[model samples]
Target: MTYRILLVDDEAMTKRSLYKILTGANASYRIVGEASDGAEALQIARREQPHLIITDISMPVMDGIELIQRLREDGLDMDIIILSGYGEFEYAQEALRHGVVDYILKPMKQEQVTLLVEKRFDHFMKSRQTAIIKSQLIAPISSAAERIGHELWIANEPGMRKEMRSLSGLLDDTEFMQEERISLLRDAASLISNRLQPQFPHQAWELPYEGQSYGQASESFAAWLDKLLNEIRDKRNWGKRGVIQQAIDYIKTNFADSELNLEKVLAPLGISSTHFYHMLMEETGMSYIAYLTQIRMDHAKELLEHSDLKTYEVGQRCGYPDYPHFTKRFKRQVGLSPSEYRKNMQQA
Candidate 1:
C-alpha cells in the first residue's frame, strides 16, 4: 500500500527538494501535502492523516516542538522525522524527547532522505498488519458470546454451561493484544447480558471494574460469569417446574379449543419453542404433542364412561372435529374404535 507523507518547512525550495527526493526514491511513498509552518502541517495532518511526517524545527507561528506537543496531546499516532541545521543540534535533542523517529541535519543528501523514509515505512507496515489481524480474531468473539448466551438462557443444562465456559476461554487466547482483550471483556459481557437477561428479568449480571488492566479485569469477569451462571441455573431449576405447571394448567383448560399448538401455548409464557421442548422432555419425559394427546384421551375416557355423547361428538369435544381422522388416531392410541370403546364402557 502507498504510504502518505506530509512535508513541513518554512522554505518552499526545501519542501520541493524533499518532495522530489521522496517521490523519486520510492514509488510506495507519496507526498500528500507540504506545509510552510507547523500550523499548516497540523491542519494537513488532521485532514490527510499521513503515515509519516517530515517537519523542520524552526518555523514561524507554531514551531515543530509545539506542534508535536499538540499532536501528542490529541493522541495522534504517526511517525515523525525532524529536520535541523547543524547549529540547531539542541532542537534535535529536544525533538527526540517528544518522540520523533529520527533527525536529519540540514544540507540533506538524497540518500539520507530516502534511507530514513524506507526504514520508517517498514515499521509502519508491520504495525498496521498486526492491528488488522488482531481485529479479525476479536471480531468473531462477539457473535460466539451471543450464541452462548441464547443457549445458556434457553436451557441451563451441563452441556450449555460447558459451551459458555469454552467461549469465555476465547478472551484468554494469546492472539489478542492486552488492550483489545480488555475492551472485549466489556463487549462480551454486554452481549451475553443483552441476550440472556431479557428472558430472566430478575437475574442481574454485569462486568466488574471498568478501567482495570486486562489481566485483572479478565479474571474478575470470568469469576463473575461463573457466579452468574450458577445463580441462573438455580433460578431456572426453580422456575422450570412452575413454567411446566402453568403450561399443564393452560392445556387442561384449553384442550378442546382445536387451535391449541405449541406456539400458542408458549406465547403467553414468553418462552421459545426450543426451550419449551427441552423443559417438557426434562420434566415429563414426553414430547409436547404426546402429552397433549394423553390429556385429550384421558378426558375422552371420562366422557365415554359418564356422558351420553356419540363417538364423533366425543372426539369433537377432545379437539378433533374430523370424525374418521379422530377415529383413526383414537384406535392407534387406544387399540379400539371409539364406538367400540364406548360400547365396552356401556357393558362394563
Candidate 2:
C-alpha cells in the first residue's frame, strides 16, 4: 500500500522539496494534501486522514503543538514529524511529547528525511492498523479473558481450557515481536488473576510467566491455566466489586481518549451495561458518566494548574475535543472556566 502523507508548512519551497523527495522514483509515498499553516492542515487532516503528517512547528493560527493536540483530541491517530529552523529548535522539541514520530531541521536534508520515514515505515503501518482497530488488539484479549473468566466462574474446566488456549491466537497482528507477545500474555495473566484471585485472596495464583521465549510463554500460560482449572474445581464467588474496580481502572487509564465509551469499557468486563453502571455507582457514589467526567475534569485541573499549556490544549487532553463543550463542562463541574481556574490556582 502506498503511504499517504499530508505536508504542512508556510513555505511553498519546503512543500515542493518534500513532495519531490516523497514522490520520487521508486518512492512508495503519496503526498495527499499540502497546507500553508496548521489550521488549514487540521482541516485537511479531518478530510483526508493521511497516514503521516509533516508539519512545521511555527505556523499561523494554530501551530504544530496545538495541531497535534487537536488531532489527539479528535482521536485521529497518525504519525507526526515536525520541521523547524535552528532558532526554533528547542520550541519544536516540545512537540515530541505530543507524539511526533521525529523531527527535521529547516534546511531539508532529502536523504535524512527519506531515511527517517523509511526506517519508521513499519511503525507508521502499525499506527495505521491501530487507528483502524482503535486498540481492539488489546480489547480482543481482554474480552476473551472476561469470557473465560465466566467459564471459570461456573467451574467449567473444559470450557475454560478451550478459551485459555485461544488467548495467544488474538495476538495475530502482523510483525508482533516476541517481547510484545509476552507482554500481551502477561496482560492475559493479569486479567485471569483478577477473576481468580478474588476467590482466594489469601493465596494468589499467577501465570508462571518469566522472560521466556514465545513457545515457553505460551506453555507457561497454559500450565497456569491448568493449575487454575484444577484449583477452582467448584463454582466460587467472584465478587462483582473486582469487575467494577477493573472498569474503574480502565477509565482512569483511558480517560484521555475522546472515543472512550461504554462499549469499549464493556469489552474487557463481560458485564452488562446496567449491571456495570449500577455497580460503579454503588462503589464510587457516582454513575459511569459522572465518574469518567470527574476523572477527565480532575486531570484537566491538574494540567491547567501545573502546566503551561493553553486552555484548549488542556481541555483536549482531558478528552474534550470541542473547546466550547469543555468550557461548559468545566464551568458546570468546577464552577469556573479553565483559564479562571488556572488564575485562581496561581494566586493560591
> What is the lDDT of every predicted structure here?
0.77, 0.77
Candidate 2 ranges with C-alpha deviation above 4 Å: 25-27, 125-175, 183-220, 234-348
Distance from true location, Cα of 28 in model 1, Å: 1.5
Error of 2 at 184 (Å): 5.0
Candidate 2 clashing pairs, residues 3+ apart or interchain: none
lDDT of 2 at 268: 87
Residue 93, candidate 2: Cα error in Å is 1.7
Per-model TM-score on C-alpha atoms: 0.56, 0.50
**Pick by TM-score: which candidate is best?**
1
- Model 1 TM-score? 0.56
- Model 1: per-residue lDDT, tens digit, 1-348? 999999999999999999889898889998999999988899999999999999999999999998898889878879999999999998889999999999888999888998999999998887777676656544446545654564455343453465455555666654656777776667777877777655555344444545677768756766666666667668657454777768867887899978899988998898888988988765444688987886687567657756998888998999999989888888887777877777765542
What tens digits encode model 2's per-residue C-alpha lDDT throughout 261-335? 999999988989999877765455467788788778767876886699999999889999999999999999877
